[model samples]
Target chain A: MTLELKDVSLRFGADTHIYPTSLTLDPGSFNILLGTTLAGKTTLMKLMAGLEKPTRGEVWFSGRNVTGVSVRSRNVSMVYQQFINYPNLTVYENIASPLRVARIAEAEIRKKVESLAELLKLSPMLERRPGELSGGQQQRTALARALAKDSDLVLLDEPLANLDFKLREELRDELPRLFADRDCIVVYATTEPTEALLFGGNTACLHEGRIAQFGPTGEIYRAPKDLVSAQVFSDPPINTVTVTKRGGEFRLADMAAWAAIGEFANIADGDYTLGVRPHHVSPLARGENPVGIDGKVLVAELSGSESIIHFTMHGATWVSQSHGIHPFEVGSQAKLYADMSRAMLFDKNGTRVAA
Target chain B: MNNKTINHAAWIFVLPVVALVAFNAIIPLMTVVNYSVQETFGDNTFFWAGVIWFEEVLHSSRFHDALLRQLAFTFTILAIEVPLGVAIALAMPRKGAWVSVCLVTMALPLLIPWNVVGAMWNIFALPDIGLLGRGLNALGFDYNFTRQPGDAWFTLILMDVWHWTSLVVLLAYAGLVSIPDAYYQAAKIDGAGSFAIFRFIQLPKLKRVLTIAVLLRFMDSFMIYTEPFVLTGGGPGNSTTLLSIDLVKIALGQFDLGPAAAMSLIYFLIILLLSWVFYTLMMRSEAQ
Candidate 1:
């Protein structure tokens, strides 16, 4: 069934957890809610799940208004960030809980529970309680339970946030595959932009209780509608610098000017914010129209495959993430090349100007 | 030669606590043991008596009656209070100003002195002048706690339940509040009804505190003395006489110190054995 949230908003007194928002999610592909923590991704999910009633607006499911329906009455399932399971129940029972609630036959429950357990690699721990299991195992049990429900709508609220790094990676690769055959609308909320990109689904970038941008995950990453969307879609954060376009050249804040090329050349001649991904601004000159700028390096970090450098340029601190090791000394001046062709130009109101 | 260095100074730090324990608990217990085995006549004259007091107390019909009465009272109160307290806690407001208000109201009865609670109920249940008594009589039911054993048992159990159920409520409420909201929300999404939620989620989460509650109430009610003594004073013809009251009657009323000490030892053993059994049973599921 197609789930549509129409102008739903949640307010607690004067505080708005989620502004008036609308989203239509369909089955087949994951609809990712991509944002930093407290960006109202969870609140919007709660609204969709009927856990919390919206202050205003209606939720439509398959062309029916279900705004006032209780979560128990709806065919829905949710897995929380905290590995929430029936602590007193064994892994087998935990997976069988939703089926039991639905009054399914015992044989059917056993069949579904065992299959889901095998799918989650929890067959060995079927008799173990949640308390006896590891964090990842518990979460797997919770996921198995959510899957066993086989509901039309499944909400995963940062389901891997509480797990260790290795388990998160393990689950991340399996999540999409697990939900592939299910005829349900799956909504996954996450704070990490890289996770959203990894999922490669439709994404809604939330910022301060509002949807900054909503489109295909790759599209939003390649061409963010605004500076905020770009920032929300970047890990080390999209570096931004205000530059003036005049006389067929771009002049940065007290920095050298470079000839405007491609999409940058086509924009109107006015003061605009230029946002570029950290990887685009590298220590090596590689892209078209590369402009070099010198700045004092603040910190240099290397993570086996790449070196990330934080430097201050024209009173604004910017990061340069490049492949391979190029360690720069702290407090020393270093010149970095930024690919102007890969930059996104935004107007004074932060809206993308260039195509 | 041993290479390990031993630190003897740690013993100095533990000395004071050991001394305190010896003075308060160990010495008194030894004295009780000493008294349990010997018979004392007038002031300084004493004679060794082998398990005679124990045999007498154990086989006596009087002790049996009081033991049965005590067991019945304790189990009755536990049965009434635990579920009632849990129900009340579940019904209480989870948040807002009403939370503190409800907590304070629940705590009011607990804060009252044991004797004061017994006295209050004693007066309250007086057949003629008390509100409960007059109201019951007005309702035309033949009721008199001072005369009937059944009525006395009712009054005593009611008084105990009123005075102590809040302890269970407070403990259960603490357990209930510590559970994260995610469980409830997940249960809702899983299509669990109210009883299922309680049975699967609330009861399991409350197990730890409920264990403690049942333990405390079990021990306290099993060895109950002050409240029932003040309220009924063992009542007319010893019908309401519990173990503690009977022991007191033996030890002080008849000056039968030897028998009382023996009975006290048996009482202590019973509580310890039962508590261990209860704890094991309650925690047996967890070991899995």
Candidate 2:
């Protein structure tokens, strides 16, 4: 089944329509509506879930118009970031709520709830009230409840955002596992760029109510289509700085950069910002080489197993994720080289500049 | 929180409630206890009545009539209002400007002064010239609250319902709004009918708010006098005389201070005891 949003626009009051946008999702593939807060990511999901109506367009589900349909008529379920559990219910009753409403046989409801409980390792807490459970347990119950619906589409609005670090890490894999067996479309939304990369689905970046880029996680991370796309995504934020082009070569602190970047070689010279991920930059020997740049180490943070080194080149500052414990003193000169093949470029307006 | 700070601040927070109870409630209760054992005539004259007044008040035919009438009136108001309010709250829109519009309109009845509420209903439900009475007469019905016991009873009940159902509606609506979209979303995916949604999700979630609504409405209806008094004047006979009306008649009309005070104490205890019972029952259910 395929879901399509065609020229959909949601206007708040009389003016300020979020955006006139269109997109499509294929069933059996995970879709991530990754965006910043207040970017209307949830709004788009709500539109598809039949919880709301778009001001101006049709929502086609399986080649049929489902716009303006009540949430009950449309088979859709969603889990929110707050881990929305029926506070008045025990975990067993919480998960069984949906099935009971469907009038499933009591025996089958018992079997399904128990089985799901075992899968999520919540057997011991099934009889416990949601109010008495821990955050992780509550979240697990919420996930189990959402998965129990067996809807054609499942929407999750950062269900893991409210979790603490260790719990977040533990359940990171369980999210994909929730949809592993279902022949359904799952749309997960999050503001964290690393989460999108971690989710590793068909990542769709929804920025400012529009898709900035929608593609495979690896491709989007390796080579973002545009500048805001690059910065709006990527953790430690892909380092960005302005560079001048001369003799058809881009120069930033004397680094010999490539002139062509995939499909961007035909662009003209202009004031532009160069983007590079911290992991792509490497420490090099201090030498008068034409292919490398030298800088002073501004700061270094050693976070347990790994260290993040800050290097200043000319007037711009950039970070490099160093291996092991590489301690550097302030004001000490440090030489670093950029991996030009992995570098990204953007114009003055923060739009990706074609190579 | 840390234990030391919590322990230190706990009594500080509880002190005001304790003091207010002592001054406004507990001490007055002691005076009532003292008065229940004595009798007084003019000029501070006192006699060891020793439960004579309590016996007389309890055995009084007027008190018995008022008590039975009070129970019927309160239950009638509750049975009519609770379901009616829940239906109105259910029919209310989930979200939008319309939600606010409906909420504000519901709150308007609450904003009217209690006596004015009585006056408004008095004029609205009058027999010959009143809108309802005139309208009913026009519709080919003999509706005179002043002369007919049935009319008086119906008018009193109807007027109480109009003035107070909004409280239930507001409380139930608040409970309904607080329910997260997740529960409904879950219900929707399960293909729940409206009735199932209410039974499984809405009713359970509304229990706490419903408790408060129930107790407040019961107390208000139980103590109700103004509107019924204004509309029927507790007249055509004792058909509309609730406990509060009887208490007022004995205390204010007949100048029987001792018996009235004794009845007032009983009335206050009934309200307090019923409120406590409701609160405890609701809390126990929540605990379970």
Using lDDT, give the best candidate's number.
Answer: 1
lDDT to native, each model = 0.92, 0.81
Tell me the tens digit of each residue's lDDT in model 1 across A77-164: 8999998999888999999988988899999999989999999999999998899899999999999999998889999999999999
lDDT score at residue A88, model 2, on the 0-100 scale: 74
Per residue, candidate 2 scores C-alpha lDDT tens digits across A45-153 of: 8888887789998999998998888887877788888877777779999999888777899999999999999988899999899888889999899888877878889
Alpha-carbon deviation at B273 in model 1, angstroms: 0.8
Q: Write out the backbone clash pairs for model 1.
A: none
Task: Categorize the docking of model 2.
Answer: acceptable
Candidate 2 — which pairs collide?
Answer: A264-A354, A264-A355, A265-A355
Q: Which stretches of candidate 1 lie over 4 Å from their true place?
A: B1-3, B41-45
Looking at candidate 2, what is the lDDT of residue B240? 85
